[model samples]
Target: MIQNPFARFLTGFVVAAAAAVLPVAAQQAASKPDFHQWAATPPMGWNSWDCYGPTVTEAEVKANADYMARNLKSSGWEYVVVDIRWYVGNDTAHGYNEKDPAWNIDAYGRFVPAPNRFPSAAGGQGFKPLADYLHVRGLKFGIHIMRGVPVVAVQRRLPILGSKATAADIYSKEGQAGWLRDMYTVVAGRPGAQEYYNSLFQLYASWGVDFVKVDDLSSPYHKPEVEMIRRAIDRSGRRIVLSTSPGETPVAEARHVAAHANMWRTVGDFWDSWEQLKEHFEVCNRWAPYIGVGAFPDADMLPLGRLGIRAERGDDRMTRFTRDEQYTLMSLWSIFRSPLMFGGDLPSNDAFTLSLLTNKDVLAVNQRSTHNRQLFREHNLIAWTADDPATGDKFLALFNAQDQELAPASEAAWASSIITRQTPGQSQPVDVDISGATTLYLNVRDGGDDIAWDHADWLRPTLSNGTQTVPLSTLPWKTATAGWGQVTAGKSVSGADLQVGGQRSDDGIGTHSNSMITYALPAGFTRFRATAGLDAAGAAQNTGGTLQFLVFTQNPFRPMPADSVRIPVTLAQLGLRGPCTVRDLWTGQTTSGVAGEFAPYVRRHGARLYRISTARK
Candidate 1:
């Protein structure tokens, strides 16, 4: 049961002594705090939007708490949150909620905790009892709230705590300013405004709230509200993790948000789509450098396994992602260090979905690593690599995002130049070859803001002798946008396994069946590359391979496949060093060469990789 006295504490500005008497250096030093140091710690927790919706109940919250303690505590997942409309709602008997008159009493426009929902939350002490309960069980408690000062505060002329101010004095005289009028705009620097913000934090602090996720703060450039909230939270003397919600914050604003809030969203609500996944993959890689401890760039929720439980406006569809795609999504998110807030109903978790969530290797990448990867997509495939600074292990993931199963002879599209062309008036392509791809590893960061990619063309090829680099200007350009399309190319490999767990029954290593590793082994191989697809003309209905590669072998990195195919390769048909092409990232170039010595073998992760040694053209 949640409990906390509903009270508001207005923030008051403290006037510091004049700094003119101090040394200039001391003044500057005084102004600087080790914000990065404060944020280095990893955040752990579970959100309520998954299992329960707006009508979340105390009994269900307790059950979730019990589950976290028994199964996920050691795994560092804590924080039992009651998400959305907790104050003005009641528990739903079935899967969805019905409005109950007993729960109809509204505390102004602010959705204060409803007594029917939390019987123990006496006297408007919304989440205090639950927070205390979680604390006793070695867990933490959190709740969700919408942005802006509550509308009830304005109507009733509620007195702000810790000051002689009223809510009406704090909110902007202009009232709501955005298309969304759900929250009243509270301008910072307005009389009693800081105090109003401070009072809200004081209430949470008194309630023992460890986390507060505020919605509607990102869309309207609510920097004033955001800044005031930060100051109030800091002044509350309690360490509360602040999370902003609902939309993508611009790259320029990422640093600002990082300085104040613990996390910010990087995209609109993420559902399940191969194209959305691909777009998100590209976006995550682009922002990897900005992420660090404390501040995280949220990629939205993990709508995996199950979805559409709340007022969420999607058909209740089981995820359409293939097993291979699920693996790709998890691996990529883990590598990019995005938050893994599952959106599936917990009690109904299937064996396969549960297994996917609990995979130790996958979780390690998301929570333990310290570095992140940079990715480039060409043709129907994406190339990803992260370097481990500690052990020098290079993690790599290859994805086939095309709609059609690719044939052997089709031409692969190049995505290496996509980044360069994103800038206005930059019509030319880059120069480079994809042949020099290597096994670079990376460290994991909590937020996605610290990661930065200064220049798209700065990537240097990891090439061996005779590796030809192509300039970008030579290849023709094609445009792309959201939805209703397929990218295709020749027969391709999908996914990678950095290290093979062990030998398996099918003579492959992936957990699922049919995944095999492909590679073009070279004598003293320092550099190797392959080309697949970036764009396709028409859609193929699960017919051909969504070309991808996965690595299963550690000592010798190998590419894995979701399914197997018989590509007839006879030494008599083609001399050693066969004809092949690979995309280049640094210059956006694709160079063709003869195929190399080919021996087909399935590695771990049920995938295969083909090593194509290029012959002189």
Candidate 2:
């Protein structure tokens, strides 16, 4: 059974704090270090675990890095982090092979990159070459490591660098991390323990690493090891952002973690599931007080787009979340100021997936907002608020927690119970009335039954003083159609066309030969279009055996027209008095014109994305 994160944290924090006592001056100095200065804003990047798992390779990392540099770098997406077990040579797609293990270590008992997987690390060269390559491309590199000294170091009794005591002298005979089998905790204040951690960061700094995500450290709240790691990073003469992981990190240790690390996981490994996303609302709310510059409570990675392709936990396929849920995930993470890490195969991202990453307006809320708080929650309906630091503009987010579609009547009832700012903690029933409002925004979950936007049902809002009903149908929304690629000849292809299914001969690097499609969009188009098909029948089943519609302006797989489309609808039709700029949500480009209709060509199972914006002069 999973233990309660808070209870476990409180218990561990008390015990660890009591056991690790240092000089009063030293403890105060350690706590006062300016760790938050490294990450002034929540870091946005891509990580490997959600897609490739233990089987990720140097080439794959470079491919993702190239993608980020080319497409996402301009938007402040920087870090390219390799997750756990990079030092294990025998690690495969499924999981680690412990019985026939191959360990990579230096003479000083520090784990090094497996030379087989990272050829640059061969002959004593660690990740220096890879880090250099990333730096040249204007990207930051990161690596994952577990807490404590390697068990092999202890067993081999290697001498700790710069210390007379050996690894065995510092290793604790009791309390190995429960999940990882290769390490043993180092006893705090041991003669060689500090030197051991120092040497580890020294090596990392030599390699030009910008981030270090230490796992198995937060849940048990190993105070001593955390301090040791912090001290090592400080002494390395480099600025490395520290991230603690494998959480539901105890809420009780918020301040402590913030002082020691840049970002800490507030939940366990998140996946493409609605249940997990729902649970984050409460967890984020509980940890909201601890968020600030450099100290972010991570919501884990965004498991959007194509994930688990040859990953350890599951099979290769697209994510299981619906388009609506994906939007909700992005909205919640941004408003709460959680670190945004994309956890899908970057090379295989669809246009819609790329749009989700490139949204500048949404990303601003995450990168520049302040005073984030959960304004109110009523049963399945939840609301959040954040203020833009520069302009003091308030952004509000409403969430529908229920799985099924909420009826108009029920929406009004729920909206009525939302007590406004004045009536804090008390609900006074009021009817929602959004009459004569110049601009109305509707947060609708679905496109009406057909492609038409005018037929959507409205959601009523309950305010402190009055109530307002907003028509969802009148709001600008997205519409899409999706289905599975038909199986052919014992195989599966992405489009309606079916062909021979057997695998093709490998192209030397373990990939099968396959056909590719490329297309461009027409000018003055409002509809977003995309096509999703499986590479193989087996991979399709691993991905829920269905096609998902996602909207994007630029075609993800091919070049598309860059010309802007003039939507013909007038500002009056959209409840606006002045001129409005129609923005393409996928490309983050704006086209100024009267709102009109433009039907863009869409391939079967494709998607389209668009939104309207108006500036008051």
Candidate 3:
């Protein structure tokens, strides 16, 4: 009975087919070469990008690894990944010197750890020494690499190892990525392309690397290169986990990605912001059907705790997310079963942040859960449900996406309406009724170009009976200052600075501009549709702005008014029946109830996790 159109479509074919074919698929998946042998569960680890960016030094990597070994290793956190441009000798905390990178390469054509940055990698030892150091402490080592053959190798015309062809012979001129200029893609069928990949993995194996996060290969999904990497890893006699990055990876390529890479990113470089976090709910849902065993739809790194100490984008500071939002982020990532790669400076973690990372009961959901899906999403309210395969416990996560706080208020005085809907030639406003209903839903549709600058279509309808006005700029829309570069590009750019009304300001950027507003409905209505068009003077600028509204409603099942309330669970909600025990995962407290609700207060932008277990009669 999910109201969302996409959810209803998914329920029909995807869910039904999954139930019928999963057992066999699970069995065959286990036998696959890139299955759980490398990552039995979603890889739990620490990545350095959020803190140090591309300039993380040996000391920083070691400090984080040491902290993990001493503190977090026992709780399943292991990999110490040094991310991006590590070979660039002149790299700084701000960004990398991509053009004049001082890459460490040997006579053939594989990148090695820079000795000046990683002192232990001196004397031609490569990362073997550093990997050995981490291995001794019961940890693993990882490094980031851009997909394709190094451009320098092609310039030098280095011979491909174990092959007659040179790097130039196998490299494609049209295969270079737009962002990184150091590499060019390998033509899959060209002679020595597979051999070049084999040599690269062989060198990485020699360095004892346990993980390789390959970037620029996922957003467009370089299938040929992925297959080459997979083949190379198999031939290298190493069990390295291959993680694809900088994504919104095409969900249609799920089978190819699953067969090759251990994990694939579902979003691009996740940071600490509510706008990015809210965007993830949709991305994760699209990729949720693909998660299993070793093949994880990575939600990128967890940008928690203290971040941007020396990051590429933004100044040094603690995460901008509120405490409630942090909890919500963690809960969503856990229930979705995305790989947990903490992106903060591990050595600088405070006790509260550490508690969020080390929660075993909550971690169990990420490590062991099945049939994970978005149960319902109404306006700013979202819910996800999953089941523990070992035990028949059910886990439910509810999220409130609005920026405003949810509080008790009188429903009788409230009225709601559809503010305005504009298309190329039409604009209309209509009234809605919510007198007896407990939920309200808002659906925003975008008919503009689907380029990086244009925002994606977002729908956030919630059950409600009261209303509050919210400012357009105050909503969690991505905004940027004038001088801000394209570091966090794409739909992340907020259209707030553009013209708002139908009139254009003398700002010299645009012509006609459009904006959205939220209004209250009258009473006793369920749904409405709206359309809008955007026009900008410049080809690259966005002409539309986003707006948000708030509503207050009591939990219909529980009918209680407090920060916390217990609502009874039924067979319909959990897909189970009879008496059940509700245990708060965070508080470690239990309440005996008959397949009913458990009480826990969810913070603003935060979440509460519970283990609902049926009682054996």
lDDT of each candidate versus the true structure: 0.50, 0.63, 0.67
Q: Which 10 consecutive positions of candidate 3 have the poorest summed lDDT?
A: 508-517
lDDT of 3 by residue, 160-256 (tens): 9999999999998675765557898899999999999999999999999999999988867788999999889888988999999867688788777
TM-score, ranked from best to worst: 3, 2, 1
* Cα TM-score of candidate 2: 0.64
Off by over 4 Å in 1: 1-42, 90-111, 173-181, 315-320, 404-617
List, residue by residue over 1-617, the lDDT tens digit for candidate 1. Answer: 00011100000001112445656654664554433333343455666674455666787778768877876677666767777767665454212233342343223323456777787786777678888889998988888877777655676777776667677776753535232243477767767788877877777888898888887676434787888888888788777878787656777776677767777777654556554565676678656766666667777667666654542333444565667667667766766777676666555567787676665555665665655655455544554555444443334445555443322211222222221112232212222232333331110111122111111111111224365533222222232112211111111111122111121111111111111123333333343232211211100111111222212112221244444332233332222333554332212344455244222322122212122233333
Judged by whole-model lDDT over C-alpha atoms, candidate 1 comes out at: 0.50
* Best lDDT among the predictions, by candidate number: 3
Cα lDDT of model 2 by residue, 1-617, tens digit: 11134324333332334435545644554454455667878999999998988767899999999999999999999999999889989887755566877999999999999988899889999999999999999999999998989989999999999999999999884667544588899888989999999999999999999999998787657888999999999889888999998676777888788768889988766777575677777888888767766778898899988888867555688888877678778888988889998999999999988988898888887888777777666554566666665653455555655542323423321122211112221112223233333222221121111111111111122112123322222233232111111112212222212211223311101111111111232222222111122223223121111111121222223233222222223344334544555554434666675344422332211122334455645
The deviation in Å at residue 126 for candidate 2 is 0.4
RMSD after Cα superposition, model 2:
18.1
The alpha-carbon lDDT assigned to residue 281 of candidate 1 equals 63
